[model samples]
Target chain A: MKQNIYDNPTFFNEYKKLRESGITYNDFIEQPAVKSAISCLEGKTVLDLGCGTGEFVRYCLENKASYVLGVDISKKMIEQAKIKTENGKADFICAPIEDINITDQKFDVIISSLAIHYIEDYDGLINKVRNLLNYDGVFIFSTEHPIVTARKEMDNWIKDGEGNKLYWALDDYHEEGKREQHWYIEGVIKYHRTISTLVNTLITNGFKIEEIQEPQSTSEGLNKMPKLVNEKRRPSFIVIKAQKSCVT
Target chain B: MKQNIYDNPTFFNEYKKLRESGITYNDFIEQPAVKSAISCLEGKTVLDLGCGTGEFVRYCLENKASYVLGVDISKKMIEQAKIKTENGKADFICAPIEDINITDQKFDVIISSLAIHYIEDYDGLINKVRNLLNYDGVFIFSTEHPIVTARKEMDNWIKDGEGNKLYWALDDYHEEGKREQHWYIEGVIKYHRTISTLVNTLITNGFKIEEIQEPQSTSEGLNKMPKLVNEKRRPSFIVIKAQKSCVT
Candidate 1:
């Protein structure tokens, strides 16, 4: 049977709680890099897939976007997005991004954060994204870095009682496919895609990559969040911005 | 101008010296794994490419093979191969594997060791190997690990004054291409290919892979060569055995 991490109630609730408490790791480390990669959102119709609590939709609205649409597979995530977003300012769809009907919609921008890794077929989804975007539209996203996702266990670091790290180890990096995590839930599947596979798939689908960054904490940002300093040892996530090709 | 590492007299001499020292890294760790991956070599016609010093060709001869052909680009390596072999037992060809004509030859086994990565066109070479082999013939080879070749410096580990290790770092692994190193000679170029690209290319070229090994020294073996224990930290080489298609 097909399953996703966001579908698990315990995992989703815990994830939503952390995001609501403003203690999310992606918010501190990855979001800023992803946000800066987006060139312009003003007066553009934006579509955010896997939009938890409509965060990107709201950000687009705040930046004076003309229209916004958010899609998520989780029912509660859409509920949260609907409650936080103003009426008529944004629209929410509670369906997997794969099943969503984008035939009548054309977007000026498409963005997803910490998503797409759950989806198995990259080539098909990329083709869909290419058709849904305007010729000039930019697609930007962040996902778990292949290095991090390759590990079956994310707890490779040796930590002391006070939570100080003593060492970190990397293994099985060349192997790719479904990886399972059991930290806060059981058998949560996350797809491990290599850098070559990920970037090559995008280029194959007629997108020209503009910028790619493996986000590291700036000195000031690190000073504020000292725990994030460990992220510099290895990239925690990958952010890429690609512009749609004018020709198929 | 066209070039291969075997073309440089200085580099080739050092490589020859190291291999003859009976203390080579590949001999200690990778060779055994690559050799054992083949099921049977007895009474088989064997073609060994990049067959420096005719080690594998000699191995085939020792195993009571009916015929063996060793091909290499280096004159000195071919000379060494001739010196070590008896008349009518094995023949040595002093030509690049890419330029050599194998159309007149059909072999039960094709083997290469710590080679093929130097040649840029893996797909072309793989196709050639397929054509040169009889149906059910197994092709066994090994190449430098992607992780080791990705580094620009080649020396990712820093050692203390006493030669104790202080740090081991990994970077630039996602990128693939030529990496220049100044080891025993000036401006030595080594071609880098990722695991995905290497294995995928072989598969695409119509070879059915049987077994793949990333050799690390076993504990008892490591104890015999304590320095080889470091090789266990990460695979230094990848060994693959693939059989020719039985059907046209």
Candidate 2:
């Protein structure tokens, strides 16, 4: 099931399998991404676009947020949320990110994590997130580093023993929205947007690049051995925290 | 650094790198496991214990859950969640799973997706989950598949070719609370529980095993590839949904 994760139960199921086996999402989501998003959340009303399972929603509530709204397209996920939460504290809605209606209520903060990559249209998604926020509201999000999407050939995307980390050539990455379909899943879609494309889209959507967070890898314990073997390596993830232009 | 996710800028920064670079939590938490978890969540009060980033919380919420409580140890994660959701609609708490004062609340559904592996004591973890649920409350969760964990030889983990796709050798399928430090992030802890450990834990905790979903690769739409190309592969993940015993 190589199809895009949304359409393919098999592909998504495989991922679920991996999680159950042993790996914890915290190991991957880590601290840097969560912390950066929290820094911008202080005393602000927030709209968590693509709020999968309300992780960030819970985060904001405990941090003294005045208001919050979490929305997602997955109805099954929302049902789970309803049972686990008290409605007086946090609200969750089921709606596609693309078709969300941003009514009169305005939010000071809007954040998404690793969820935007699944969207087929980049510009439309950014514009939608922009519409949901109040004037000068901050929008901070973290996306799958473009490098992985730009280059799908697994072999071309690994570290070698040449005393340095390796990356795939540019050609493998330039292909846009490669089609990976499966019987058990619908078409798997990924739009590989470079940092430049990402920046330009925000600007087009009236967002100013207030901050750019590039979380690099650290060599403390187990990583020291790998780093000692190959010191020159680039990190795999990036966190971008931007603000809705107060200028307008 | 562990006190709050926001305090640790590295968590966000490094996580961004991994996401951008193409390493995803999806790789570990697959779709099949999620669907299996969803199957059990119909009209149930779910507690997503150790719910990081609340993906499963959203899943339960969307599935028409009667109620949900998204809990995690990371205060910063809880704060981001507050920022993302409406207050009092769904609830979120910042507390360790062990310290959770869950006496009055008995969930119909208690779930921990890719979270429990962090608890080093498997028996204690299961007993704790059992204590939190009501009679017939389904405790459904997923973890990294045992085959994948047994294949921690590193080099042999990522194999390709052969009739079996992504074949992981089935070796030690029952190890309880095997502890290990995370590879990418420092100061994080993880535990590996085998099938026997998981099943026995459920039985010992007075929960009847309801379903064990084993997913195999299917070439539903391979252009010219034979369906036999993927078969009898070692499980990369496991989704176990068990119900609390009403009798006894």
Candidate 3:
């Protein structure tokens, strides 16, 4: 069966098995890069949206976060998260982020990894994030880059019968929204928006951007996984660190 | 005093002189492609926005349009238009499109060429076009393509002293909105939005898109102006035909 997200009970189990065999994309590339972006986790209340398999939660806990909440739209993913939890230090909830109350609690840092691209309405979610944060609180997130998302024929040209490389085709770079992507799995619908729309939405919601990053292979990553070097040609993801600034 | 739009008495006079001397960009491209997008203007009321020198109005008049309105931000352009206009067959108005009340007169065809990029808000203007159109009324417009508009450098690469080719650097393709472009005129601010944003906005505002075109040189146009061939590399303008469908 094709693995669907959020509530796929066997999803993490199969994925973990793949990672153990060194065939996983995230274990080598995105996870480590996203982990390093979290600065000063100690004594902070953190909310991790789309916390699939609770990787970031463990990172925050290892870094001594005071309290952590891992919210995932997938019930099965949250089930896996719960198995790793103890005491009241870390928590996992199975609910769509759009339905979360967020009123009874406040967070010092809010983070989502590879999640926001699924969201259809950006402005509404961003505005909601602004309202959920404390004054000067931080929000850090990562999603698929527009270039990666905008591509229709994400296929590189294959060699002909004589082993001659054909053209590497990338079309409709400017067309955005709701592209079906085939990666480790097939038929994954992802929403695309320009970097300006993403950044401008943050700015409109009173956030001061700290960093806009396109993660690439470190020399160490390249040493371990040589194929990672191809990221320099075209970025696959974008990570942004922004702060809620007090604005008039 | 620096020449301002709408009432820039010197803007068109200087620009016309440049075109006369073969020093203008659009004189060689875009204008003809845009004019041809108007399939039929016979017996239709045509409203042309930012109708500098009323060229489209004259075209529509020659094609036997019922009536035509040429509204330009530049008074000097309208003044020149007036010299060519005669007794209510054509009329010219000097006003910003945003401030103009389009409700009073419904149109069968609305065309804006090389103008919407200067306007900051696209959704509002497109919605206004919808409201001002009769059922099945068509709105055809052309603006600077987002790729050209997003360019910060706006500079072509040149050979160095040793005749080495310089970089054809195209960075910031994903960033949208305001970019300062320099061509014949210096420091001209043009707003850029991705093709998705532009098309999606039109769809969102209840206009059924008929065609989306990147206006390039025809073989005939290339013969008339050899420099027009360059449009094949990177399109300078996008022409869209959207209709306000009679839907409940």
RMSD of each predicted structure: 11.1, 24.8, 13.3
Tell me the spans in candidate 1 whose CA falls farther than 4 Å from its real position: A1-10, A14-248, B7-9, B158-167, B218-221
**In candidate 2, what are the lDDT values of residues A1-248, reduced to their tens digit?**
21124323565466445534533333343334546555645577978776755666777887778788887776655665566555675788888766778687878887776667767787998887877878878788776655445444322334468743333222233245653433234445555665446665776577755445434333342243333212112234556666676543
Query: Candidate 3's interface RMSD, please?
Result: 11.6
Kindly report which residue stretches of model 2 are placed more than 4 angstroms away from their true locations once superposed: A1-31, A40-42, A152-155, A158-169, A172-175, A179-187, A217-232, B1-248
Candidate 1 at residue A123, lDDT?
79
Better of 2 and 3 by TM-score: 3
Please, what are the lDDT tens digits per residue for candidate 1 over residues A1-248?
34656657898888878777754567677888888888888899999988988988999999989999999988888998999999886999988887777779899999989888887777787888888999879899888877577555656554579986544444555456788877578777788876656776776687765666777766666766787777754567888777786655
TM-score result, candidate 1 = 0.57
Better of 2 and 3 by DockQ: 3
**Candidate 1, residues B73-140: lDDT per residue as tens digits?**
88888888999998796899998887778677799999989877678777878889988999888899
Candidate 3 TM-score to native? 0.52
When candidate 1 is compared with the true two-chain complex, its DockQ is 0.04
Q: Clash number for model 3?
A: 3
Candidate 3 per-residue lDDT, tens place, B1-248, comes to 21244344355556777655643446555666567667888899988888888777888999999999988877677888898777678888888876668557989999998889888888889988888888889999888876565445555333479965332223344456677765455667777676556766776677755555665666666777776555543456777777786652
lDDT of every predicted structure (CA atoms): 0.77, 0.59, 0.71
